[model samples]
Target: AGDIKAGRAKATQCAACHGIDGMSKLPEAPNLAGQTEEYLVKALNDFRTGERKNEMMTMMAKTLTDADVANLAAYYHSLGKQ
Candidate 1:
């Protein structure tokens, strides 16, 4: 389990593309609201580990700790029912 408050705080960095509420601000960024936690975690981890190949995501994800990943995933997944 992750801390929603902590995730929200950390999500400021993500708000430029992915909105404060997990919606996307730009067309290039997919809306993250209602995504599965498992899927978000996997995608972030893949970006961090170089398994995924988005330049922006790779750079952004590299600094994330495991807890950060979990928390972010939890926060985004909690946004809406899918």
Candidate 2:
């Protein structure tokens, strides 16, 4: 389990596409709110590892540490019901 408070703090950079509330403002970005933590973690990991490739996401995901991925997944999942 991740710390929600820490996750919230770490999510500022994600707010550009995925809203602060975990809703995506851009059509290309998926809404992250209410998504399963496992899904979010896997998606981010895929982006990080090149298993899934979106140009922007791949770049962004590459910079994230393992803890960052976990925290991000936690924050997004906390936004609403799954």
Candidate 3:
């Protein structure tokens, strides 16, 4: 498991859309608190590569490095659903 502290810092930007607890209040946004790491990584990659077509997600994913993805995935996985 990665450091939660580190993950929190990286997750700051994510909170705007995802919420602090990983639950998105928006209808279209999916709750990510308890998602699998593999799924999170795939989604991030999809956004980054344009395989998925959400403008905001694509822009957000572009800001993340591989380590950022791993750390965020670990953090979200730790939440175990909300």
lDDT of each: 0.91, 0.90, 0.82
* Candidate 1 displacement at residue 16 in angstroms: 0.5
Which model, 1 or 3, shows the larger TM-score?
1
lDDT of 2 by residue, 1-82 (tens): 7777788888898899999899889999999997999999999999999999998999999889999999889989989964
Q: lDDT ranking from best to worst?
A: 1, 2, 3
Return the clash pairs for model 3, or none: none
Per residue, candidate 1 scores C-alpha lDDT tens digits across 49-72 of: 899989799999988999999999
Best by TM-score: 1
> Evaluated with lDDT, which candidate comes out highest?
1
**How many pairs of residues collide in each model?**
0, 0, 0
Q: Which residues of candidate 3, in runs, are more than 4 Å off?
A: none
Give the poorly placed runs of model 1, Cα more than 4 Å off: none
What would the TM-scores of all predictions be? 0.95, 0.93, 0.88
Q: How accurate locally is residue 5 in candidate 1, as Cα lDDT from 0 to 100?
A: 76
Task: Between candidates 2 and 3, name the one with more favorable lDDT.
Answer: 2
